[model samples]
Structure formats: structure tokens, C-alpha cells
Target: MEALQAVLKSNFRSFDRVAVIGGLVRDFAREGRTGFRSDVDLVIHDSKEEVALLAEKLRATPNRFGGYGYKSGPWKIDFWALETTWAKKHVPMQTLEDVLLGTFFDWDAVAYDLWERKLICHDDYLERLRTKTLEINLRPNPSPMGNLVRAIRRLVLWQLVPGERLMCFINEYLDEEALRYMQKKEEELFSYCVSSRWKTVEEAKFYLFQERGSDDLQLDLFQIKHQR
Candidate 1:
């Protein structure tokens, strides 16, 4: 993972800030939140060419650590590239953000510590990015579990609706690995729900919650203004 991080830092020299968002970021950093399985989504604010150039540079690097590299999209408005296997698989959610989009639908409060994040570029840009970071926390509606349930319903609906578009959306945004795990968990939870395993929903809720502590960020310092 550090190798990928290194490539990103070296290639995108002008980025004001770079963050490993999506599942990889959450797994390595955020806890208590639900986990995901898929490619590492590195979200950075850079131009299309800058992002493409970074992907090109990284793709050139030999996979000493054994990982595939490729690119997708020149979506000018968003400016991101989806790196995945050169060929398609039965996999769902080809991009890193796909799995996260459903879960972390809320806006994120992206803070930058000059002393911490590997920020590049000029001081003025840094100040501007910092200001943007501090002003708002991106909140996505729907709980994490709610997002997962919604995704499953979509998958089921794809069968009933019988359309290529919904299939494509599922393929684009759902993580195959995570989806399988979720299916199994849902099965188990359903069995528990049917079996009257707990006295009430509230009683069962405690077991469903993930336990995590404050040191999860691995940041040098931070102040959580608010979190749901």
C-alpha cells in the first residue's frame, strides 16, 4: 500500500492534498465503521492530465508487490481514473469509490494538517485547501447498513427490472468480495432475526455495532468537530 502511496506522491507533485479514501482508507484508518474489500481509491484534487499522468507513471512501475494497474475515464467534471484489471471479471464494483459511494454517501470533513499529510504545492493553495477542508463535513444520508441493504435491493431489482443499465451500475459500484460477505452476514442476521435470538431489536443492536476507539485515524493530531 505504501508503494502505491509513494507512486501517487512522486507522480502528482502539484497536488495540494492527497487522501486514500474509500475502503482502503477506512480499513487502514477509520474503525467502528463497516469495512470493505476492493482496490485502494486514492482521491486527489488534480487536473485530468495530472491524474492520467500519475496513473501512467504508476502503471510503468513493475509490480514488485504484485498488484494490477490500469485506468478508466477522462470525466472532466470530476477528474478521476478507475484503475483495475485490464480485463473484466465477474467482479462487481470495478472502482474503489463504488463500494464507498453506497456506504459513505455522506459528505466527509477533510482536514489537512501541514505537519501531517504529505501536501504538495504552494502555500496559497495550501491555505485555500485548508479553508475548504475546515468549512464543511460532507455528510451522506442513510446509515452504512442502510446503504448495504439498498444495494442488495438494487441487485434484486436488477433481476426483476431486466435492464442493462442497472446491471452496469451494480457492476460499476458494488464490490464483489464485500457483496458476498454481506450476503452471508445478512443470511446469518436473518436467521437470528427469525429465530428470536434476542429479546428485542434494541437488544440485538448492541451486537451489530462495531467497536472502535479514538486512535483509529493514525493522524498526528485532529479535532473531530462532529460525527454521527
Candidate 2:
């Protein structure tokens, strides 16, 4: 970890709001699990080039992780030049406002904002991520028993949501502009499933069923569980 901080301080000109998030953050603080990787994340308030420069310097270092070609920066910058994407998904503003901001995550793997710490790098891009997230409609943390319920809701919404109707929505909705947000979320789903010891959603669904242990609930493709 010290090597990571040293590389960032040496390579990058300046940065802020550089706290880690995602599985790495959860692992260090909570007892959460994630797929094993030597890579250390530094979520900084900086540009892609800023991150890339750090990775280059780290590549020249002698550390074992570095020697073994372990990544020392954001995972995406290693790839070719591409257009960045962002999203304005509906998060419950009401819930986000109530969350105790500032580096908080739960055992359930839910993310909450750190509203107090603010910094700017790359023309305040991190600020934009934080502020824009405020507009996101956050939902409450789901209990162990809530998995099946939430899955059922998602399954139903897949049918009811407007964009779910067409593959053209893939091209239309997933325009170049939306790729960053889409890819970011897609990676998240991958990490969660891999780390949680669930091979598929069905396995998690069965676990949730055992938690609920209620005969009243019935599984069906079309049925919406506990309508919101």
C-alpha cells in the first residue's frame, strides 16, 4: 500500500478525493470478500493520463506485484483510447441525502457517499461524479432475505422498463457516451457475483428463498414480488 501511495505522489502532479472504493475498499475495512488480485486501487481526482503516467512509473519499479506485472492504477487506462461515458440513472435522492456521507460502506456491499470531503483534479471531474451521484435515487440496504425480492423486482422490471423492449435499445441506449457508466456498472456486477461465492443469480435466489422460508412466495417469470 505504501508503494501505491508513493507512486501516486511521485508521478501525479496533484490529486484529491483519492479514497478507494469498490471491492478493495470493502475488503480493507469490512470483512467482505472479492476475487484475489494483487492490484491496489487508488480512486483519485485525476485525469486518465494522470493515472496512466503513474502506471508507467510503477511498471519500472522492482516490487513483486509490479515485477509480476500487477497493475498499480485504474484498470481501464491500460486499454486503448476511447470515449468516456457517464450516466444519469434514477437514484432516490431522498435516501442518498439521509445517508451518512464520508467513506462509508456496509457488510452488505452497498456504497454511500462521503459528502464532506471534496477535491478537484482534471478540471473537477471527481466533483462532477460526486455531485451527479447526488441526483441518483439510492435505495435502502437489502437484507440477506431481500435478495430474492430484489431479484424478482429486477426480473419484472426487465419486462416493464421501456428500453427492455428492444435490442436496438442496446445500440440506442448504450451510445458511446454511456459506455463508461455501463462498463463501470457491468464490472461491478462481475465483481459482486465472483466475490460473493455465488456462481449464478439462481444460487443466490435459492439462498434468499431459504432465508425467507415462506410458502406464500411463488416463483414465476412474470410475477412481481412485493410491488414498490
Per-residue CA lDDT of candidate 1, range 5-28, in tens? 454555544666444543343333
The number of residue pairs in model 2 that clash at the backbone is 6
Residue-level lDDT tens digits of model 2 in 1-228: 455446545643344334333344333433334442344433334454654565565563223211112344643112110111011122211222212122112221222222333321224323433331111122322231233223332323322221122212222333333334433443555332211333444453344323331232244222333321
User: Which candidate gets the maximum lDDT versus the true structure?
Assistant: 1
- Residue pairs with backbone overlap in model 1: 105-140, 106-139, 106-140, 107-138, 107-139, 107-140, 108-138
Off by over 4 Å in 1: 1-5, 31-38, 59-103, 106-146, 149-228
* Pairs of residues clashing in candidate 2: 91-136, 91-137, 91-138, 92-137, 92-138, 102-114
The segments of candidate 2 whose C-alpha lies over 4 angstroms from its true place after superposition are 32-37, 46-204, 212-228
lDDT by candidate, in order shown: 0.35, 0.31
Backbone clash total for model 1 is 7
